[model samples]
Target: MNSASMHPSDTNVGMMLVISAPSGTGKSTLIRRLTTEFNAFTFSVSCTTRAPRPGEVDGREYHFLTREEFLRRREEKYFAEWAEVHGNLYGTPRQTTMDLLALGRDVIFDIDVQGARQIKSNMGQGCYVFVFPPSRDALEKRLTGRGTDSEETIIRRLAAARHEIADSQWFDHWVINDELDSAYQELRAIYLAEKTRPAYRASWQAALSRQWGVS
Candidate 1:
């Protein structure tokens, strides 16, 4: 819980982290835990063509967009990455994240595999983490329990989940969501580890050496 312990890297540069998981795998909940607990992290709100659900707020939950507007921006290269899921289009803007990273804020994206890949290709940076449900049965049950989607939609999501799970092999880290607290701890540890990587902190080390009058 100590911010200093979590972030020992006093570097001016920040990292971009992309978290991808199947719809029912609880990635969103895990992301909330990280953002709430970590002071150095910020969430990148994505644009989506999907209509807001109950209690969802515009810009806060997502930057709501019409299909035409989404496609227009996509064509203009405004999005660093974009993908369509369950007939809805979602995208992360390039300028938003770049500006944040330039300001030394770590940015986290809650996106699908497609968008994650595109972000890596475009930005050439980011750590990808994929969360998996304990089992297919557990995933299905979680989706059903939401009651936000119809049975048909739930079935579609389950089918998509199979492919998403397979894609986890490409991710930098895999966290299984068997339990909320356990999964969150695993994710937090991964973030801390990435932040402390030698490459990430090399410049900071040099600066400290200079301050201490080390040759």
Candidate 2:
């Protein structure tokens, strides 16, 4: 089998890369870089009941929905995974995600731990990664430095960070965002390695089988 001839685009199955981290752990930045660098990776835009932030566009950053609409969709099981975070309801649309995967597009998720747990339970496959800050002080500094949250909200987020980190033990990989460039490299490597997994390489296997005259 000439495995070297197999290209990434030849893969018939896509990967569900689920990533979770505390609010200030730089998870969003990493995901942005990944999707930008690797054009094949698709960012799963989630539906959220929270109002869009300044300069955030609807259907780009999130599919902004009213609380009533969100609840109605939740009851219909329209979301692959949904959770309440910071008092806002957020959910990943079920059909959209499955359709992308069916088309062999690697979908990446930027969600909280609760959402990640729901995804793991509902879908047993895919890779789960947890991002951690270098230290407690660093996390606090980042949260406070944002200046977007009130003092009370910052404290609440810090507390939630602890809980999220504790629950992250079940993740398949953990990346510490001490240095942005180094962390990005490590994350990129993980995705590249995951692409080689047997489940994602059905086309490659078929090509090999044909070369060997196997049924």
Candidate 3:
């Protein structure tokens, strides 16, 4: 769709946002808040081979698949980005995310660092945001407090978190999840500011100028 025929708020040139963080960093919670506040944003439902936890619904939480099925899909290149995290496979569907952006809807991905990096490479134009824990102590407390994983799993996750933190330089923006409200505000500001950047808004601005007879 051309910008000339679309309203500023309803343009088809939407953005792809890839948000990455280690487990228990409140990345999911912050993303939930952002999507709720911004009606124009659509959360991309990822495909996973992991069994859903209690209170997790199909399609809403994830598209659960068996290992065999996931492997088959991976071979077919159905995923934009996929990675094994803590023994479970997670992936984002390539076509669906592109379809959303083509229809003027911002797509948000809450994925692992590996998957986020793959998406950035595949799309080459997404906003990469890395969420960090306020402190190592806080990360430990949060992971232990979740009460979902075994001690072994927690140790593995903490190790993974350290590796992910080391890759923070790959991200375009960073938000520290010290307090939920403050962290969310920082995330929201990054998104809003990105949308207003000259490179992103140039087409819309040109369309507006043309409409106003700017010569």
Candidate 4:
């Protein structure tokens, strides 16, 4: 009922962050480390039209869906944001995040720049952070070294990455993944600092902070 408190509608003021990086730049690894290290933050799972890769589970790695099902959801306007990448459609459904954050849990998204923009615009509580590698060459080597794509495909990806890398400024913070441990520490610091933002801390009032040993 008060403006200083979380609006009766909006929730999760700890800061919802969008973390992005060029392919093979270790964004996945960083996200894993981040979620594991910070008990309060969680990686938000996405929904996609692509089939699950080996070892990926349904509703975990991604919410795998048929193209028809994906388009049907699109028609219903159920996605917070959606994109077609490499011939497959990927999206983040709004409800899962809404439910989690409504319960006072922080949500972290490993989405691309475009998705990040959409979510930031739609969800005012969210923040965007870009995890960047040192150089184009390093990104190239990292992707190719995995042996997942052909030389031609890698070239195409690198070209695409150039544009994405330029888009980092579109985010609130750009943390370079040049040194893994250092970057992780810095990202963790952002979490700590965001928690102290007056707006965010005020959401803690008494109940939520009590869960984390905060006043």
Candidate of highest TM-score? 2
Which residue window of length 10 is worst by lDDT in model 3? 3-12
lDDT of 4 by residue, 1-215 (tens): 34444442233455687788888788888889888977777656788989788999998889999999999998887777899989999988887778777666788888777888888776666767888888988888888899999999999889878889887786878888888999889888887776666565455456456455656
> Residues 126-195, candidate 1, lDDT per residue (tens digit)?
8899999999999999999988999999988998998887777878999999999999999999998888
Each model's lDDT comes to 0.86, 0.89, 0.86, 0.79
List, residue by residue over 1-215, the lDDT tens digit for candidate 2: 46565666788788999999998999999999999998778877899999999999999999999999999998998888998878998899888887888888999988888888888777667899999999989999998898899999989999999999889899999999999999999999999999999888788777767787653
* Of 1 and 4, the candidate ranking higher by lDDT: 1
* lDDT tens readout by residue for model 3, 59-151: 998999999999999899888898887899988888888888777688988888888888887777789999999988899999999899999
Q: What is the lDDT of residue 138 in candidate 4?
A: 88
- Point out where model 1 deviates above 4 Å: 1-9, 45-73, 84-89, 202-215
Candidate 2, position 197, lDDT = 93
TM-score of 3: 0.80
TM-score of each: 0.79, 0.85, 0.80, 0.78
What TM-score would you give candidate 4 relative to the actual structure? 0.78
Q: After superposing candidate 4, which stretches have Cα over 4 Å from the reference? A: 1-14, 50-69, 206-215
| Backbone clashes under 3 angstroms, per model | 0, 0, 0, 0
Residue 10 lDDT (model 2)? 88
